[model samples]
Target: MTIPKELEKILEITKEQNTWRRKETLNLIASENVMSPVAESVYMSDYMSRYAEGKPYKRFYQGTKYVDEIETLTMDLMNQVTSSKFCDMRPISGTVANAAVFRVLANPGDKALIAPVQAGAHVSHTRFGTLGALGIEHIELPFDKENINVDVDKSIKMIEEVKPKFVVMGGSLYLFPHPAKELSPHIHAVGAKLVYDAAHVYGLIAGKAWSNPLDDGADFLNVSTHKTFPGPQGGAIFSNNEDYYKPVSRTIFPWFVSNHHLHRLPATAVTALEMREFGEEYASQIVRNAKKLAESLASLGFKVVGEHLGYTKSHQVAVDVRPQGGGAKAAKTLEEANIIVNKNLLPYDGPEAVSNPSGLRIGVQEMTRFGMKEGEMEEIASLFKKVLIDGKEPSQIKREVMEMRKGYLSVKYTFQDGEWEQKFSSKVIPMII
Candidate 1:
């Protein structure tokens, strides 16, 4: 059968993205990862044409037999990866997943105990987040700057006083294992459900590299597939308590989300199963690389966040750049040299605005994926010192930055295979340059 020109044009457009993939630079943002090849294939597979709403194997629309198998594998893989009793692998993203959770759990104006956005809380749990516009009240819990973990005593006291309906246990930045076991009992004492947002550390938890909130007394868990977990952009919610199954699914289906994205579902399910196989080695190395990088940056006089033991036990590290200039300027300077990192707010900022804050967040996942290790982190830290601390010209550092990046060419993905390296031959659109 001859292919239609319209479908041919769409394929050409996809080919353009394939062609341009290699020119893109570093993705150092904390909440991102390179998905596996099987995940990538299923993502762009013919399943994209189907619409399988409702639940797996049971669809309102027709032609869902194969798609049903995909969804079943996705949910089962999710269950295996996190050891959860139940899993939902379709919220579009982590932010919207939290929105679904709030829809099921809270009413308008219901108080939510959460750490502030400026204090490393994910955007979904703060005033500027999805829940904020939904009329949920937010109560900020103070954190300990020294340890970079929750001040459990202070948080519990505040929970006792506010008695919020929900308590958010996870933050965007993690330097140590959360005291979930200690905090969960307190939240329950005040009749609050602990909703653990594990978007940043889901893979680590899957690999047993970090604390498992579900086992530690979290009533519900929300996570993203991209960060830590090597999957496409999507969100999920799971619960051991059977009561949440109905309300959570109802809110996600008819209330908040209409039809889940079928294209993302198959890829996500495939990636979830891949994580079950290769996630331990990858997740462990991510945390180890993070620690090494943090230590190296600190040794270079960069004032990296956290203190002893590299100030982190996960896949992220933050450096205080305000003494040099500030997070915004430093980020822009680094970007000029083809290095990418984001400006973030530190808890001790006292009263700094969220935009263009004082701290810089660095991630080790992508660099680790590129096969760079502790020595490379040290060399890169020196380069950072040259630009941010020593005030050298960015142009001088740019050459070295390019060389370092070039040296760490694409390594073989244990799970993704060689599809990522296959460059597209045809470009629908001409090169921009």
Candidate 2:
């Protein structure tokens, strides 16, 4: 049978995106990452078509024995990686993980404390998103803009005054670690649970490139498996306290998830095993590249944030791009040059600045996974200067970007070396019958 024209066009577009994103471009998006070839291969398994509604070895459906074993292995690996006593691999996304916890811990009309949006709280933690959906009232934690963290003393006072049911730490725009150790006692004294949203930095934590919230007094750690973790896209909930395990697990199913995405189990297991072996090295390089990139950008006259704190301690680096036509315009320009980045809200920006905010949030994890290091970070910063500061045409800079990308195509920190090219080559090209 002949392939339909529209279907062929779809295949053509997929091919273009795969080539452009995976091969030709420098992906610097903080919330994005590439799965290793082995993980990706397992991600495309027959498990995608099946469902296992409950915990391992116990399910609402049949033919889930293998699924049970795989999930159990995945859970064990997750616990080993995070050093937590309990883990739930069921939440489909980080937001779903947050929702599950919220439903389990708080009732409607309960007050919750969260880092302010400007300070990096994800929307899911706000009253406008998941928290609001659960009918929880969320108050912003006091932020110390100069220090770029939660104002510990002020937040403690607010916690006592409001007595929220939960206090959420960690965020999407995070640059430094929150004061989890400092606030945990105060939060618990007020009968509030400490929830750390490690969605953006869980991989960094696993790699030992960042602090583990579970070790720092967080009662619950919620995370997305992708991003800096370099795994399949999914979410996991972890806690050192086993007392809260049953309630959290029960809430994940029958309330938030049913099938729970079986395909990601083996892929997640592969990633966990990879992290156990290579996470430290990968994470160390990621932070070094981020700091080097920030310094290079700052030297080139870009307004890199956190200058007072030595730029950054994680894979993320934010730049105030208002000088170069604001973040939205600058991000679009960089995208045209094949240097992918995202517009972001800075601490000084108003809530309304989200659409065309003052900053660009760049992460080196994906590029670091592609084997680009500190020197490559310098090259990337130079490219940014050319397009944004020197007023060069994006098309002109795109040639250099592609040339720079050519040498860094292979993914590192995984079992298979140079296997992504072989695995994806045929899939990207349209199949003609």
Candidate 3:
């Protein structure tokens, strides 16, 4: 029997995207990463066709014994890597994870303080996203323009004045660390809980290259299992406080998520083991690549953000592309040249400029997953210069970009076949590298 026309079209488009994204172009999107073949193989198991509601041992379904084991193992490995006492891997996405915490931390019409939008407050933490949908009042903390971070002194004052129910820190396009350590106390003083959205930096935190917000007194750590973590696309919430975590765990189930995407558990477990074995090197290289790329961009006359604070401690590099006629133009031009990055809003950009802003959000996590290091970062920066500053033809640069990409297509920082097969059968979690 011949394939139907619609099915044929869908198949064609799927293959095209798989080839283009995997082998043709470099991916610089801060929010994406590739899963390893080992974990990916585990991803396409019987779990995809099944369901398991509620916790591991106490599932609300019957055909869930294996999934229950997989999920519990995933949570245990995640907890081991992140050093959290309580873990909930039920939220299917980072936003959902944030929503669960936000729900438990405050009621509708209640107030919450978030990191200044200019300094990287995720939309979920603001009145424009989940907070608005939930009817929570979101107050933006003040920015320290000189340091390109939240103004701790002013934020403390605001936390006291508003007496919010929760305070959110960390976000997209964030270059430096949020002041979680300095502001956690003030957040608690207002009868509020501090939440750190580590979605962007979870890998770094677990790898010991970045600070764990739990140690900084934050009540919760919300994360995307992907991103710098290089895991499957899912989310988990972790906390030392049972009161906070238990409620959020309940919220994740009956409210924000239902199926919990059973397939993600085995894949996530494999990724967590990979992080335990190789994450220190991978996370360290990501930071080095970000800094090197920023320095290279600066040398090429691109305005790299946070130049005074050593460019970046995380895997992201924020740049002002206004001279190249704003981020939209730069991002489009780069895309034409087979380079991938996103147009983003700078702190100074008004909410009205959301469509096209002065900033470009470039991340090293994906390229780092492909094993591109500091030297490749410099090469990438030169390609940016050639495309944007030198007015080189995009088609010509696209050829060079493709050629460079040919050398780095396979995923790195993951288990080799022989190594993983042995580990996959065992109950032991690897010691952190």
RMSD of each: 5.2, 3.1, 3.8
Q: Among all windows of ten consecutive residues in candidate 3, which has the lowest summed lDDT?
A: 424-433
lDDT of 3: 0.90
- Candidate 3 residue-wise lDDT, 323-431, digit = tens: 9999999999999999999999987899888889998999999999998998999999999999999999999999999999999988998876676668763543333
- At residue 31, candidate 3 shows an lDDT of 92
lDDT tens string, model 2, 232-329? 89999999888776899988888999898888998899899999999999989998999999999999999999999998888899999999999999
Model 3, which residues run further than 4 Å from truth?
Answer: 417-433
**Least well predicted 10-residue stretch by lDDT in candidate 1:** 424-433
Give TM-scores for every candidate, taking all chains together and pairing residue i with residue i. Answer: 0.88, 0.96, 0.96
Residue 338, model 2: lDDT of 92
State in Å the error of residue 239, model 2: 0.6
Q: In candidate 2, how many Å is residue 351 off?
A: 1.2
Please identify model 2 stretches exceeding 4 Å from their true place: 417-433
User: Which runs of model 1 end up more than 4 angstroms from their true locations?
Assistant: 1-24, 350-352, 411-413, 416-433
Look at candidate 3 and tell me the lDDT of residue 425: 37
Instruction: List per-prediction Cα lDDT, in the order shown.
Output: 0.77, 0.91, 0.90
Question: What is the number of residue pairs that collide in model 2?
Answer: 0
